[model samples]
Target: PGVWDVAAKDNRGIMDVAVFRLSKKYPRANSVMTHNLPDGGHVRVASGPDGMASIWDYDIVLMGVSHLTEAMNRYRAGLGEKPGRSFRPHVSEILKFCRQSDGGRQYEAVEAALRRLKQTTVEIVRRQRGKDGRPLRVTEGAGLINDYKAVSHEDSGRVTSVEIELPKWLYAAVVEAEHPEVLTMHPNYFLMTPGLGRFVYRLARVAAGKGEARWSFRLIHERSGSPDAFKKSSAGIRELIKANELPEYDLAEEPGQDGPILVMRFRGSFPTPSTDTAGP
Candidate 1:
């Protein structure tokens, strides 16, 4: 009986045909002719106090082997094989077959592969665009409606009022752009400002509906504080506009809830305030 326990323990550890044969040959002195013995091929041997059986059956062994083989196959599939680039073409073929023969799995697989291909292609194109500058068209204009100005007394700084003329098209664009903060400062007069090269660039973007352009300008200033400085600058802007024949607009100054702000009047309607403006 003691040897039976030892044999059971050995069988539990080794779990082999050789160990079973050894246990059967070396029977213990007190061993009863128990049916529940490992040596008896048909009997299920009781190993512990809980009466748990230590049965080494063919079916269990076969199942374990199957599971191990499956695991190895999965590992090899993941690491050993490289995914083929022809996957998309293959998937497309399968999808065609599915459409013709009504195979659901093939159709689904093809759809998924096509989606993945599209995403990958978009990413590649985006990367290429980032490396290169965005393809955009640029338009240049000499003069554009920037700001309004009037003559001011050198002593009192009171504005000697003057009316400004704005182009219809320029007015429409400015109104559409919605710049209002430009008028809030309430300078005495509408200043003839330089052609806004940068503003023109942004406007070009709006016009083209893609990419961006940059504008640069050179300005002539008589004196820093002279009220006439704006008036003089206006002449240059006017000349540029006239030479370019660019459509211009009027930026009307009005009182806002916060303070004075410029409004763009295009056609009959006054649009929203512009975000782009110079100065406080």
Candidate 2:
């Protein structure tokens, strides 16, 4: 997503540095695509009674997972485990990560995203890649989240903390990374316009390793589970590059007779989280 680039506009850069680790990788988050994830998540979004993918955005799940990675890293570095799940994240911490504040509107949005994450059920099974570079086909299903709780102060009336439970699939994926980098994202990722650009960033975080990776427009469209037609999808990619929204990853379009190919390059390293703690 154009998160890191977008974040520069807001000036809140105190969040922890995030990296794309195996556990954080999901097969395009159709929530489908694969990265170096120890076992890429084979996610299939379930349709609600309305016949559309649940009002779900992978960003919420990504935010929580990113924090979980941070906490887990701290744990391995000798930090004590918090209560409930092996990883516990404070509401404020999550808010800061998602580029939101304790303001009523932002707080409500955070609560709603948390609920969507907990209520929406996805058919997600994780599989390891075979030695020959093929996915070990498997069919198992689990919810993105098992349970969650939020607490608010009665007087000031703002959510102060949050607790979440991950199903077996997620828990396994988190600890699966042999050496997790705990990929950090721009706090602005959550603020992205819900569409192709955000999904592209997720893939770049995992797929575009220390160098560059290329994908055909069709591949990105299919991976993103976008509702737009092929022509429209192809156009979107060019628009993204022109807008310069994707600052962290360098993106360019390779025009083709058949269509267009997206070339994304990641220098693989980002600036350390800024110590300027001036904004939310």
Candidate 3:
């Protein structure tokens, strides 16, 4: 259990889990991280110089999912459109989607993120019951992305346009599947900082949905894949709950049988745009 790749304590008991397997922690040095799913699936990620693809990198994945999901829905509505796993988006467009500024440094950061996502390796073992009632294990190893082709400006060699190919697993989950499991994120999500704040927002989105849900601090600590000591991590999470800056959600802590419990409640989403054009 002391191994860096495995959780210090068994986390399989946690009932709420996110579909996306991204690190809640900030980008760190080269290391290997792991997560043990409640359903007995295991994920191992090895990162290099750029570090593991943190939740920030997941922004790109979200964008791709949104694009494909809209395209698929349009096709389903007889819009004469075909949705594919790959997409061509301008670098500026991606930056705007992420709520980031369009600058030379930001462009460099995007390139670095792509590298980290492409270079990081993930090994997954999915356990399931076979037809004969026997345990079956399927192992797969690949990066977060299948491939990324970027077009850069000839004068400055700055990336301009990028075409990204989503992995088969992701493609199947979002576009190819009959019911895509995609969720709508708040626009303010991009304004948040990287770390537990971002991860907890996502956890609330997945676990609580439009209702209230509770999880012990210990469970959150384990599920967060945080390297900090339990006390420190819990303290940080407690602070976050008190601040309650997460968009479309309200967070609070209450006493529980096991130490303290963090509770998340849906605060509803952003307001709809008005068609009223009255002059002030």
Q: How well does each candidate superpose onto the true structure, as a TM-score?
A: 0.14, 0.67, 0.84
Q: Candidate 1 on 25-61: residue-level lDDT in tens?
A: 2222211111212322222121212111111111111
- Tens digits of lDDT, candidate 2, 195-277: 56666766666567457887778777665555558787778888888885763788988876667888888744554444222
| Angstrom error at residue 114, model 2 | 2.0
- Candidate that beats the other on TM-score, 2 or 3, i.e. the better one: 3
Each model's C-alpha lDDT? 0.24, 0.52, 0.69
Q: Where is the poorest 10-residue window by lDDT in model 3?
A: 1-10
Candidate 1 regions exceeding 4 Å error are: 1-137, 142-165, 178-181, 187-280
The clash count for each model shown is 17, 11, 0
RMSD of each: 45.1, 8.7, 8.9
Error of 2 at 15 (Å): 21
Predict model 3's lDDT versus the native.
0.69
Scored by TM-score, the top model is 3
Query: TM-score for model 2?
Result: 0.67
TM-score for candidate 3, residues paired by index: 0.84
